[model samples]
Target chain A: MDRVGTVGIVGVGLIGATIGLALRQRAVAGQVVGVDIDAQAIAAAREIGALDAGGSDLDALRPADLVVVAVPPDDVVSTAVQAAAVMKRGSILTDVASTKAEIVRALDERLAGRVRYIGGHPMAGSEGRGARMADPALLSGRPFLLTPTDRTDPAAVSMMTEVAERLGMLPVLLSPDDHDDLVAQVSHLPYLMAVAVVGAATDRAIGIGGPAFAGLGRIARGPVELWVQICRSNRAAIRRSLGQFRRELDRLERALEGEEPLEILLQRSRRRAPVDGVPLDKPPR
Target chain B: MDRVGTVGIVGVGLIGATIGLALRQRAVAGQVVGVDIDAQAIAAAREIGALDAGGSDLDALRPADLVVVAVPPDDVVSTAVQAAAVMKRGSILTDVASTKAEIVRALDERLAGRVRYIGGHPMAGSEGRGARMADPALLSGRPFLLTPTDRTDPAAVSMMTEVAERLGMLPVLLSPDDHDDLVAQVSHLPYLMAVAVVGAATDRAIGIGGPAFAGLGRIARGPVELWVQICRSNRAAIRRSLGQFRRELDRLERALEGEEPLEILLQRSRRRAPVDGVPLDKPPR
Candidate 1:
């Protein structure tokens, strides 16, 4: 039930504009302001009624009680630091980057006591890009991961939790490193698999490909630059996940050659990736 | 425009039942009969109006002008041979199996010149299984691949093309070997990738996994026994595709490690995958 008086959103891209729309439409914020380097993006977001006021100035974030930096993954830490410089004392600063460990550590070291810094990653997105494709309901019913270190203010985390609920998201709290590790296994690894599939299948295979191939290759069409940064930011965890994937791939190859049991491997995979049943993974404590 | 006087469908499972529904609903056949080893499957197909007549005897196929064998991949050749035995001379025999080369070769040697056999692979399916989940609309607007060799009759191919069109499918003609090769790369390889992803992520990462992971893992939840047969049937092509996949995966790993330029690889992948654009792959000749 706790609503922020004013919210400032940096980068007015898909996630940023979506959050702005959700906050404004759900009455979670008294005023929603957006700041973007691109004036056209700011105008596009404001035209969609996602922002009460928005401009291409850091000054626009000054009156806000909370600031959400929703830039590209590589720019997250820098944008948060810049937003923090303009944000008033006692205001909370957070980000919507896909990776969290590096960002959280940098922000904690730079602006720990000066301003409340919390890291966030809302696990929701559309294949479509930009503020024009932004939807208020995109955040609803999705897991909103909050990566808060020991140095992060508890009040900031609580406020973000309330905001996530107001936007109809299931807020999940975890340490920054844990967030990075888990997402590497689930999100980043799957994305890389798509990329590899697209690369391997090439034009020849894609021509005759069916719905299954299309479904598997869906995320391969995502923005490359953003994904590159995400991979770079979470290199160690992604590498570990890729190693696991290689071993699994080897098992599948061995099964195909009749050296291993195919049915058992497939049955185990089916259990791990349930189609309709409740997931088997343990929830974060 | 060419309609079969009587259509016999063996194996009233998902694909078979769906084909029956399409034929019956679209008025593509004068009479539709189904025969399955499981009496319950025949009843379920009948309940859904997928068949006008169905039983557990091969004698039901004696009057059929066209017999479609829609059993598991491993059973496809055997069922087709069995169906051919009861089918009157000059009757066309086809199948709706995922793999075509082995079955086509086996049938050509066993029933060549005796019965008209054209191999078929409908590029459509749902995650849900059995006759109860069958949909008439499942075959509509999907690619229905027909594999015919020099021994295949032209009239049989034409009749099958008409049937595909009547069911609202895009009929594509290819050699049995080509059909197996393409599907191995597109369908079978993607399925393996999903299996590998599930095996790698396991239950530990699935708890916080989002839509991307779910999308990539969708086919991993498919029937294991069926997939095992599919893999066994198209082992050579699938192994080749896996090799290509491993090389691509190596490139991705190198990209992640800053050993390769990531953006170029991603841009090429985006072009190949083609989320909303006309796919870069050449259409079947």
Candidate 2:
């Protein structure tokens, strides 16, 4: 694969730092420059060799072949718009945000043809966040979903695909709406359910204990402010997903209240099993 | 700790095999006799060194100094009753069941003073079940809740505590009802919620294109039969927990339905942070 030229990364947090580490390990021929509003984060990125040079100044990204916007979901649009203003003409741009449709729409409406922008979300993370916790192997063996709008340049998409390949990620292409809905069902909904359960049990009447609590409360540990932004930004899709979840809860309630045979409950629950997977245990004789 | 003599394991299955292994590894000076109705399981126990002698005969437990009943909730009563009939005059009996109230009630009514039965639940397990998955270190550093009825013998409780200490666990004393409620809130209800969400997603559409799908689908990989049994046995408590969970869901729904500020939703979710004993990160500066 051809080496990438100077690459600029905005928001040197967990995702940005990880991308920088991945770039270095993969030896992508690029002078990776990181830019973060937080001076401490910028300093940390430099200390960890995650950036050749980075600062709050937009001029730091002026000479890059590609620019990656790795801010929170709420900041994706404003950051992308600002970065686009200072970007070299025809420079390709991409973002690692959870929601896609909104960013795609924002870029399409506000920065048409000034620079190519493609939306991408890597389905990976740890409970911990920030550059300090960044791992080079975080994206390895994970799926990276790319949502390229009709107006997106093919070469831009191709370039980002090369970067994803260099990071050892399997890139899958989907539309913006499709990506949003998929994440709502799989990621956003589960997170909401986890938060709700943990909230309900926070009272003194219940004591939290065991691996089950940790497993169920795993996503509840996510940054509340970030989640609020995510929930707000993706409200429509999240509400739709929550509606589906509510219906399922009602079904379970009915089954329990009606004293439906155990077999019926088992059948309904068994549908949750992966279609192609065997039971967690080997078959009992 | 003094070496246990003639250990009796009732309803020999996964937990029984694991206890046997732990005892053997510690070189407890005793013969491990396993009792189970399933002849195949008894054979497997002997083959795996989980038992020195095995049979369907409850009478075989007569000489045991310590009797551990590892059985399903529904079978706990009948098995305890049968084992109590032939238990050694001064032996200590303990049961490792998920719910404690029902078993404690059963033992109180049936055993009387024939033998001492203390209810114990080790908060440890993998997604798998059966003797094949048994591990000696399963209880290491795990909390073992012991729920002893008022009528329970002090000597018996002491013996069970010693057993837990020997196995390297922290024994926590709680009332049977409290134990039931704790597990219902943390373990049983969460499993049900996970299964419900997984089922709901699978019913609608399967977008299994990322690690998020696999992460959310993990609990769904658990055995349906085992979960069905657990849900049915702990129906009353789980129902109450689910009701509380539903109210939280309703609150979230109301928040979403209203034009209320996003801060309300975020506040409710943030309340769960302190209960988890971790300081939540502040929203991005």
Candidate 3:
């Protein structure tokens, strides 16, 4: 693949640095430029060979064909808008945030006609934060969700998809609302459940917990502040998902009084089918 | 380790076969014999080199120094009693059941004054069932819970501990009630939570689930029939655990209205400690 012109990445944190490293290593970008408020992050990214050029200014993105806002979920919209203001006209702009609906809506409204803004969320991360922990292979084979509105440019979507593939990611398209709701159920809700499992564990229970118990509590070990932001950002969908979860828990609790009911509930729970009506027996990808 | 003479396994299923294989492969046993009502299972165990000798009769345990009832939870009690009756006096009898209170209580009463009954639960398993999937290394470094009542012989516990070590297990001693309660919170509750997660997931939610969601749902993919038996066998403890989990969920839901409360709850949830007052940062052992 011919090197795409300069790629500007905002934040220069884990995701941004990883994108830089992957793009540079794979020769997908002619120059991988990074900008961050934290000068230390920029230095770290440069030291790790994740950046060809780096700075703390938006002007650094002016010559880039693609600009990626890789900030936290709460900062993605503002950062994308600021980067878009400096990006050359017709150049594509995208983001790597977990939640999408609010960020995409904000960016589409604020950066309209300035740059082609498309929402991208690489479904990958590590427990450790910052550029030091960024790995080029982190996003490989993981789902790269692109939340594109009908108003989004087809050219922009195609560009982002190519970049995602170059980074060894599997690009999947969804609406911003769909993306938020899907993650609320799968990602956000499961994180909360893990937190609940850990919070509710009795001292006695902790004493004798084997691998299964430990496994359930594993996902809860992520940073609390980040998860708190995620939960707050996608509250409605998470609440709805939480309600659905409560219903299932209630069903199991009610069925506990009788052997047959419990057995039937478990049997029903075992049936798993994909959205395309495919029976799925394999572990989740 | 001196070779343990004539280790007899009552059920040549996954756990039983794994035990047989590990014992024989490590030369921990002088001879490994297996008995299964299912002739096919017996053949499979023999074919896998899991047993030196095999049969469909309890009399196969007549010369055994130790008999492990490696049957399903529902059948553990009856199988243990039967095996005890067939074995000569002073031979140790143990079981490999997920839930222990009921099985241990039944065997302690029935096999008293005959064979020394020590309840053993090796906390290792695979989603795959039967002798064909038996793996000797499956139990390596996994917890081996020993639930011994006052009536249980010290010698029997020591012998089971020695055997568990030979199988590469870390033996943990807990009372029968404690064992049931601990698993109810950890194993059984987590399994139920995984089921609830699967049951509650919308089609669209599943479509976009990343690794976190997949990891949470992985534990639920085990055989439903087996889990039903486990849930039924430890109903009271499981119900209590479910209540604790529900209370935590309720707290989270109620706190959802305010950021500070939710943040506080998550912060508290992040604190993990072992029973010995150790700040545990490690995954469950």
Candidate 4:
């Protein structure tokens, strides 16, 4: 896919700006052009040297060899469909949205013949949002999961893998359904658990809190508008993961309440330790 | 209380080394001597200038106007009892153990009139431990909770506050029981939740794991032996907080499974926002 020349980046938000920065850092030969509904965001991308040029016009992106939709989750499908309608034939398109299954289905239904569309989710971000917090190094050493459907062309998948490798990310390939289930367990479920724990701490009867509470609760402060769309779109998987977490929580509660020996609780927690892969180390400063 | 000069610190581990460093920075009109069970730790503290003098002997702590016990949680009370027996009659004593009620109770029951013991828990630490990581700035702007029982000398509490203020930590007065409950909600409960989340993720059926899982799981990686002691000693409060968390998890489970709208989940999580306080913009790099 060396013929993949120009790269069109839709939405100059954190993810878009970061991808642009990463491309520039690696000196990827393709011309990186940005498209954003926000004129100010386009300007900010230019100021950060993340784009050769960017504007509010979608037509400016039509000639690109590769198109990346980095809009919010709710906008991913619609944006891809709109961009697909105007794209040059054989040009590939992909998204960096959190959830994949729905977006993959939407792209399949709307943009099947217009361009090869792949779903991508980079498991990296700062608590802060927008262009200011965008770092080229943000995706370094992070997993960049790609969900390619049966309809996706093999060359398109390889082309996206090339970009992910250029960004210093480890690319993992999976089917759309597999990707959704995996993230439901890792990303989405943990977020819900964080929200629940935060809710419990804020209960009036408890009046319980400390720095640790704050640290654990910090995950709940994400933009609600964005998360709402994600949860609604991936309801089935999210619900399943939530059920799994609840069962574990119940097990812990029963252990705490029962006069079970402390060794049992310790053993239970220890047995579950291998899930994290790496040895539990102190939180990074 | 100006007469309370020359503070001696025993067990120059993370807490002890940090206290010595903070005292040195504040120049609190007192000499700071450090003692540790590990000769290497004592030598390390001396090399870093975290102590005016260092040795492995408890006798080296005898000349101090006040003594600070900063050992692991398990050794807190035993060390305090020993310090009380050896420290001069008018000398004050304090500790930086996470759990306050137990240590305060131990001091009250074991060393009633021998020394003025006030318990303090500074809510600050880096993942880095020992003298090499010691920084006077560690406690700045962090909360330093003081749990002084009625039997403890008011003068000792004031002295502890003076030190906290000098180090730039906000001195918060709390009853031992209240402090324990607060920390359980804040610290212990979060640690337990992290462990549980990590454990749940480890289940073989799910097979989904990555750095995000590892990042969230890092809280469980703290010295397990330390946590074992902490969980065992603070069992009552930790168990209660965990129960409260479990109830919230049950509610979330029901909501996710039942016909609750997506907005309801968002609203529930938003209401719990205060549990996190202000977002930690970014940790110190």
Best by lDDT: 1
Instruction: Give Cα distance to truth, residue A65, candidate 2, Å.
Output: 1.7
Residue range B1-285, candidate 1, lDDT tens digits = 656789999999999999999998888999899999899999999999999999999999999999999999888877888889989998899999899888999998988867899999888888889999999777777788999999999978999998998899889999998888888878899899988887887464687778788786677878888998999989998998899989999998898889999888887777688442236454224
Q: Which ranges of candidate 4 are over 4 A from the true structure?
A: A1-3, A202-211, A254-285, B1-4, B202-214, B254-285
Q: lDDT for model 2, on a 0 to 1 scale?
A: 0.76
TM-score of 4: 0.90
Order by lDDT, highest first: 1, 3, 2, 4
Tell me model 4's lDDT, rounded to 2 decimals: 0.76
Tens digits of lDDT, candidate 3, A110-156: 88889998999998887668999999777877789999998899988
Model 1 lDDT on a 0 to 1 scale: 0.86
lDDT of 2 at A132: 85
Cα distance off (Å), candidate 4, residue B110: 1.8
Which predicted model would earn the best DockQ?
1
Fnat (0 to 1) per candidate: 0.72, 0.35, 0.52, 0.36
What candidate 1 gets wrong by more than 4 Å, as runs, is A274-285, B274-285
Question: What tens digits encode model 2's per-residue C-alpha lDDT throughout A1-285?
Answer: 588888999998988998987887678947999888999998888888788889998788899888999999889899988998899989988999988888898887877878888888887787768888888777887678889888888988898888888889877788988788778887778787877777667443233356656665566667777777777778788888888777777777776665555456545555555433222332223
Best by TM-score: 1
- lDDT by residue (A1-285, candidate 1, tens digit) is 567899999999999999999998889999999999999999999999999999999998888899999999888888888888888987999999999998888999988666798999998998878999999777867889999887888889999999988899989998998899889988999888888887887565677668778886678878888988998899999999999999998888888899989999998877778442236443224
What are the chain A TM-scores of the candidates, in order? 0.95, 0.90, 0.91, 0.90
Name the weakest run of 10 consecutive residues (lDDT summed) in model 1 chain B: B275-284
lDDT scores of the candidates, listed in order: 0.86, 0.76, 0.83, 0.76
> Candidate 2: where is the Cα deviation over 4 Å?
A202-208, A258-285, B27-29, B37-56, B202-213, B257-285
Backbone clash count, each prediction separately: 0, 0, 0, 0
DockQ of 3: 0.45
Q: How well is each residue in B61-104 modelled by candidate 3, as lDDT tens digits?
A: 99999998998899888788888888989899999899999888
Give every collision pair in model 4: none
